[model samples]
Target: MSAQDSVPTPAATAPIDPIPTTSTPDINAAPHDPEDPETGEIEDPDNESSRFYGPEPDSNPSDGDSALGDYRSTRSTSVSSYVYDYQYENGRRYHARRYSTEYDLPNDEKESDRLDLQHHLFLLTLSGALHRAPISKNVQEVLDVGTGTGIWAIDFADQYESSKVTGTDLSPIQPAFVPPNCQFYVDNMEEDWTFDHKFDYIHGRMIVVGMRNWERFFQQCYDNLHPGGWVEIQDLNFPLRCDDGTAGPESPPMTWSSLMIEGAAKLGVDLSASNRFRDIMSNVGFEEVTVEHHAWPINSWPKDQNEKEKGMWVLQNVLEGLQGFSMGYYTRGLRWRAEEVDVFLASVRERMKDKRSHVYLPIGVFYARKPMGI
Candidate 1:
């Protein structure tokens, strides 16, 4: 790496809290309002949040369920400002909680996006797009699909002052105030996109399930790029790495995986498509492609000291986020009892803190450049 090259270290990671700013709300700032670190109170402006911790409504905080709700999806296509659905694809039923941002927690999903070290690292990796791929200053337009927290795009706009960065999402949960160079629009990228300028760089991350058509998405990116533009995607496989088989089938970790993997499959999304990263890029007509795979030990698989520490931290975040990822869908999507989801989340939490296990997580990072000349 050159002096200008900065590999994202664990320290550079964004926090799981809502986005905050030094003087004012960052263009996409969404900080949590719980236990305001500044005031030490439970409910303050800082405590106002979309993501919370508790087992059930008005339940104890440790239960953690109290702080959470069903998955929140906002789309312009819906007739109702908010629609609750208990039925998912393939006729599966899961409880789902639906509310409009106009009423419910708005722009608070940043709590979910920057939830932990792994996710923070993921955002850092997205920031790497600036270094890994080069786009022109004259190439003023950029798009960040599934722009969770709008962190990456905000940073991009901060770095490339001359460029305009637009972050699009199905839910307008991104932070509000952003750099003048950056802005956000609410749209389902899966549908047709109406934008004027071709982009210089297009980024999509952790959108594995939301994406139904990888090839088409890539093609869209390719078509929307300025001849030599680039696209970067970051995602990881599920069922994680049980290299030693120490994390058995009956393990909470495994049970958690079973619930997510099966349900996502039922919904027609492939959560385990990490290896397809390159294939999708190639199929989209992108050239000079490259992939970097990393070892992510789930719940600290190694006896090695450092790996164990980071692994455990990663596991803890997964356990916490799983509720919003699936139960929010199941409760909001399938209508499963809050009790059942609570127990499931509890079990996942137990396994995360459980130190007597071996685990690994595999991730794929792929980027490709469109040919500049032809």
Candidate 2:
């Protein structure tokens, strides 16, 4: 690897307590008046019941039924590999990159299915919008970095017939039949970009785990994009969070996230880099850098209609993705036995199915633009 592509030494991975826990609020209790002499304690700003949901009406935080319905009933898609050569480990297939850098997830058919499911989950989150950027309809070229199954690229090409979409990844696991305007290539984003023409818009999703030098990655994006073009990154902030104290430190999600963050850092990648994309993009000379904070509830514990639906899909996505997300990382970086890894993952699966646990993954969506007349 070139010096420019070298991964930065990450700080020590800490425990998985991203959100500070507070006492559970009583939904059915009467309101407390500040002037009342009977009430002894005035609630502090940090202890407000509305800390998690700003300006929303107060409701039962733990009101959802404990039953975790059949999340597998959601629709799923399948993929086939165009490239025959692959590397197998722990009975999972990996990319035949033949390079020093390794990816955290497998590239098998099961992982491809999970990627497609995750793409749908994003659609449900965004309410079916392909992107949040305000690009014009005349956009000529588009690029998707680390496009796992090429699902997003295919949809973009179908939506914008005037644009040509290119998807790149380390594995040739994308299907053969796709929109005429969309194409897929097996390549690495950390290397120097060699596209023949600059693009009008670029998008990357869930690529934080495989990336090394995020600054260099954004710099390459800036160099390869036309002036005034936009770039968007969608990723999940690591170390699962809990608004309530139900999913505590001993929870399976917390344990998994802590170990995964440490293991990824040891392997020269930062799992928490999603939290730094906005600052990094601005430092890279991009203008109008903006980020949106969102949450993906682990199960159907939420009360809102849309959020409840999202929770169901997110639960299925996590359940199907856990093994592929951990196998390579544990064995390679953390040095764990294959059987031990399986035993630990079994507990995670069981814990994830509990709807009353109230765990969620924080998501970040960052978008920026290259300055014009540069």
Candidate 3:
């Protein structure tokens, strides 16, 4: 059967199982003494502990309050009204809100559901943790940038009941029944932020399309974070890779990815910016930056049972949602007719089913901490 024919129909409601944290070692945990690795004890290399660790929060709580006030005053404009002026091309809808031209993605109910599906796929890939950042239990505030369907924020709120989670996106298509501590805002992250409070943790996933200025965006994230707060950025790398050279420069998948990237570049959206996130975060005054790269196989091509299963899900995600991802970019940015886009994607789908093609997309997770005294 064809890849599209084999694609599993997603259920109406897919349960997001909380990822177990025990399997993955916490990277933010106190480091072991360099002198003695056996004990796993934290020993200060420098005699001055406060200088390296940072001032205790209780020592000067007023500084945090003042910092928050400064950030709030910088961008305190009232929230804009939620607008859903959707544009349709070849039966697929694209968002017509602010930065609409730049986004090149749909925001209708169907697309929202696909985004939620993508969220679950990411969760499965990351082993269930919302992020790789070592967020403290005492965190009181959190922000989710480009929270597609607000699923991450909802899951975060459910995970940390004490923390107030605010999810911002260009579309106001988030569900109504969110956690009590979670709220959705119709806003764009590329614009200047006007948050009233500082966040202990800020999470942004798959937001490369909406961000034109990575430096300015990371700087904004730095400004809005409480001292020592964490920001985690997770994104996918495109132009899918094939290990054995079956899917190569001439392959349909590569052709599709190249076309998409070319189209996105014309719209001023850098789809390949995920690779440079580490440098961007560091230049923005973030400290202790960490990056982890994971792979999502294109189909059930892996010999390992776990990877084979994951690949199946990834295949379904790409096959089912390829049209939603391609329509706007092809029509608006590439100036291609909608019918041509569909025909090209159909060929790409067939190429994906070839077992000889061991293709996978790199999933990069970058987490950084805002320096306490930068």
Per-residue lDDT of model 1, residues 155-267, tens digit only: 67988888898777654444545688887655556656556667888877677756767777787888888888888776665655554555788887777676676766656
- Ordered by lDDT, highest first, the candidates read 2, 3, 1
lDDT of 3 at 73: 10
**Candidate 1 clash total?**
42
Tens digit of per-residue lDDT, candidate 2, span 1-374: 13233221111111221222211111222212323322111222222222222111114544354333443312122233133357889999898765556787898868877787787677666656678778879888999988887778877898899999988877666555567888776677887777678999999999998999999999999998999999998887787777667778888878998998888888988888876676789899999886655667777666554566667678889888898899888888899998999999999888877766777776667789999997
**TM-score rank order:** 2, 3, 1
**Model 1 lDDT on a 0 to 1 scale:** 0.53
**Which stretches of model 2 miss by more than 4 angstroms?**
1-84
| lDDT comparison, 1 vs 2, better candidate | 2
Candidates in order, TM-scores: namely: 0.67, 0.80, 0.77
RMSD of each: 14.4, 11.7, 15.9
Worst 10 residues of 2 by lDDT: 8-17
The whole-model lDDT of each prediction reads 0.53, 0.71, 0.66
